[model samples]
Target: MDTSRARRGSDFARLSRRVAEAGLLERRPGYYAIRIGLVGALFAGSWAVFAAVGDSWWQLPVAVLLAVAFAQVTLLAHDLAHGQICRSRRTARTAGLLVGNLAVGLSYGWWMDKHTRHHANPNHEEHDPDVAPDILLWSRGQAETARGLPRLIGRHQAWLFFPLLTLEGVNLKVSSFRALRRPSLKNRAAEALLLVGHVVAYLGALFAVLPPAKALAVLVVHQACYGVYLGCTFAPNHKGMPVLTAQDELDFLRRQVLTSRNVSGGRLLDVALGGLNHQIEHHLFPGMPSVNLRRAKPIVRDYCRSLGVDYVECGLLASWGQALRHLHDVGQPLRAARRA
Candidate 1:
C-alpha cells in the first residue's frame, strides 16, 4: 500500500512539473489587468445606462446587460480567490471582497472556503458539498434516501434544472448572507458590512434613477438572468461526471481528471464560460490563469491519453445533455416507486 501510494503521488508530481515547465502555471498579470478594467467598466457603464434610460422600457435590455456583467465580475472573483491573477493572499482576498461582496453581493470569504473544499474533493459524495444531496439529488443513493423537497421534486429535476437556475441569482445572495452568521467565516463583520452596503447602494441607485415599478423589474430581470448565467457556466463542468465516494482511491491527477468534463469551443466560448470551458485543465491547475487554461488543455489532454486515463471533452450543448441525463437517471428509483 505504501509503494502504491508513493507511485500515485509521483504521477501528480510528474504532471505538475510538465505544467510548470510549459509556463502555463505562470500568472498573467497583464491579461487580468485588461479583464478587470473591461469588466469594471462594463459594470459601471451598465448602471450609468440604467440611470440614463430612467422610466423607459429600454431598462429591460440594460438589466440583461447588467446580468452578464455580474456573472463576469463573479468569474473574476473566482480567479482571484484561486490566486490565478495575483499571488498575494491579502491582495486577492481584499479584491475578492470588493468585487464579490460589494459588487456581486456574494460573500468572498464564504465562497472561498466552500470552493476550496470543492476543489480538494470534487464530486466526492461525502466530502464535496457540490455533490451532496440538497435541493436536487446527484446520486441514486441520495434520491432513494431523500425526504421532503429533494424527494418530491427530484423525479423531474432534469426538466426543472434550468428553471431552478433562474432563482440561483437570489439564492447566491441569500446563501451568502446566511453563511455570514457562521463563526467559521473569517472577517465576518467586514463581509457582512460590504454585503449590506451593496444592497443599500444597489437599491438606492435603482430607485433613484427610475420609478418603483421599473426599479423592481430591473432587479428581477438582472438577478434571474445572472442566476441562469452562472448555472449554465457551472453545470457542464461536473454535473454528469463520475461521482466519487470514500471507498474510491485514486491519485490526484486521475481524481481530478475523472471527475471533470470539458466543454469544447473557441474564443467565444472561452469568453462566455469565463475560461471554464476548459474545466479539466482548470481543476487540475487551479492557480493557472484563466487565459492559460486553453493553452494548457491540449497539453493536459495529451498527457492523460498517454497515461490511458479517460479524457472527456464534448460540445457545450452535449455536455448539458449528459448532465441532465445523469439527473434524470438518478431519480429513476422515485419514478419507479411512484408507478408501483
Candidate 2:
C-alpha cells in the first residue's frame, strides 16, 4: 500500500484542499430539508401524543417519548451547527441555535464553539475540553490512579453523565457563559430565551396540573428519556478513538475515518442518528452533506486502503462492544488540553 497518500498533520492546508477536491466537504440542500422536516414532525408528533395523554395513565410514557424526540432533534441541531443541515452558513447557525437551545436544552453558542474546537483539535489534551472532564490523565501514570466517579464509570458508559449534567446545571451554565463570552450576542440572547422558556414550560406544567408529585414525575420521566437518547447518539464517536495530535491532522482525519465505526441495522438508526452511523465518512468529509455518507463510505474505504490505513465497520451491538473494550483497555482519563 502507498502509505504516503495519507497526509500528516504538518500538511493541513494541503490536506484540507484535497478533502475539498475529493468532494467530501460540500452540503446537499435537499437532504437537509428532509432532515429538518422529519425531525420537526417527530417533535410535533411526540408533543401531540403528550398533550393527548392529558394527565391520564399514559402521561408518563408520553412525556418520556417527547423527551426522546427532543433528544433526536439535537442530532439535527448538530448537523445544522456543522452547516450540513442548510446551504447558507447563517441559516445553519440560526437553526442550530434554535434547535440546540430550545429542543435539547443546550447552549447553541457553547455547543458550536465547543464542537468546532473538537473538530479542529480532536483529542488534543490541551484543546478538547470534551475529551475528559474529571478522569485521571493516563499519560501521567497508570490508569488505576484516576480518581472520582467519572473514572469509575469508564469511558464507554461515561456518556451516561450527560443526563446527570442537566441536573448538575453544568451543561446550561458552562455553555451559556461560554457563549456569552464569545462574539455571538444574538446566540447568547437566543439561548437565554430558550433557557427561560424551558424553565417556564416545566414550571407551568407543574403548576397547571393538580399535584406537585405528578409534576415531579413528569420532569423525571422526561429528563431520563432525553438522557438515554442523548448519550447513545453522541458518545460513540470519539470516546473509543485515539486523540488527534497537532502533528496528526492528516493522520487524524484518516484515523478518524478508520476508527469511527458505522452502525447500520435499520431506518431508525439512519434517520434518528442523522447518518452518524457512517461517522467515519462524516468526520473525514464533514462538509459533504451527510445524506451521501452511506454512498461515500466505499470510496472513502478504498482511498483509505490505498493509504494503508484500517477501516472498521460493524453493527450497533458489535460497535458498542468495541467501545466498551476500548474504554476498558484505556482506563486512564482523557487529557484536557490542546496540543501545541
Candidate 3:
C-alpha cells in the first residue's frame, strides 16, 4: 500500500478503537423509541386533520404538515437501511419496506441499492450515482461537455437547484416504480404490490372525502413540500464537499470524511435533519444510530485534525451558500460556452 493509505489505515484503527472504548456504538433503544413515538404521532395526527378538515382552506396547511410527516418517516427508513434501528437485518428490511414503500411511497430495495453504492463511493465521479454527470454537473468537465437542454440547465443550475427540489418527491415516487420494472431487483412482485397498495391508499384517502379539485390541490401541496423537505436535508451532506475521480484511492476514513460536510446547529436542526447535520461522523460510521452521531462528532473531528485531514463543518445557511457556490463554479464553463 502507498504511504498515505497506510497512514490513514493506522489513524482509522486508532479512531475506531477510541470510539468503541467510549461505548459510542451501543444502541440507544430509548432514544429510538421516543423518536418512533413522536414521528408516528405526528404522522397520524396530520392525517387526522386532513380527514377532519375535508375541503376547507385549512387543508392547505395540513397538507404541508402531512408532507413533513412523510419526510420524517423517510428518514426513519434511512436508519433502518443502516441497521441502526434493529439488530436483525430481516426486521430492519421489514421496517424499511413499511416506512419506505407503504408509508412514503418509495421502494426500500431501490434506495438500499442506490444508497449503498453512494456510501461505498461517495462523490466519485464514475461510481457515485448521486453526482452522476448529467443535467446537474458536479464537475466542470461535465459542464463543458454538456449538450442540448442539459447544457441549458447546466448554465443556470445554481439558480434552479432549490426551485427544482419541489418536484423531487414526485421524482422519487416515479423512480421507485421504475426500479420495480427491472429484472434484477429481488422480490420484485412483493415490492410492486406494496407500492401499488401505497398509491391506491394514498390517492384513495384524498379523493374519498374531498371534491376532485380540492384533492388535486392537496396532492400538489403535499408532494411539493415533501420533496423540498427531503432535498434540503440531504443537499447539505455532500454538496459543497470534495468530488473524487474514479482513479483516486483513499483509505475508508479519508474517503468518507473528505467528501462529507457537516452543518452546525442545535438539537432542533438535528431533529429536523434526522441527525444528518453530523454528516462527517455519519459517513465514517454508517451503521451507527442517528442519535449516537452527535455524541461521536467531536471524537471524529479531533481525530481527523490530528491526522491533518480537513474536516468540514459550517452553519446551515453557510453550508447552503457553499453548495450553491460550488454549483455555480462548476457551471461557469457551460455559461461561458453558451455566451460564446
Off by over 4 Å in 2: 1-26, 135-186, 244-252, 332-340
Ordering by TM-score: 1, 3, 2
Model 3 RMSD in Å is 1.2
Which window of 10 residues has the lowest lDDT sum in candidate 2?
331-340
Q: 251-302, model 3: which lDDT tens digit per residue?
A: 8899999999999999999999999999998888888889889999999999
lDDT of 1 at 141: 82
lDDT of 2 by residue, 114-199 (tens): 77776766556557766644642322232445556645554433344444534433344355655665675565677778866766
> How would you encode candidate 1's per-residue C-alpha lDDT over 171-267 as one tens digit per residue?
8899999998899899999999999999999999888888899889988999999999999999899999999988898888999999999999999
Global CA lDDT computed for model 2: 0.64
**Which of 1 and 3 is the better model by lDDT?**
1
By summed lDDT, which 10 consecutive residues of candidate 3 come out lowest? 1-10
Better of 1 and 2 by lDDT: 1
Q: Give the TM-score (vs. native) of candidate 1.
A: 0.98
Error in Å for residue 233 of model 2: 1.1
Please give the CA lDDT of all the candidate structures: 0.92, 0.64, 0.90
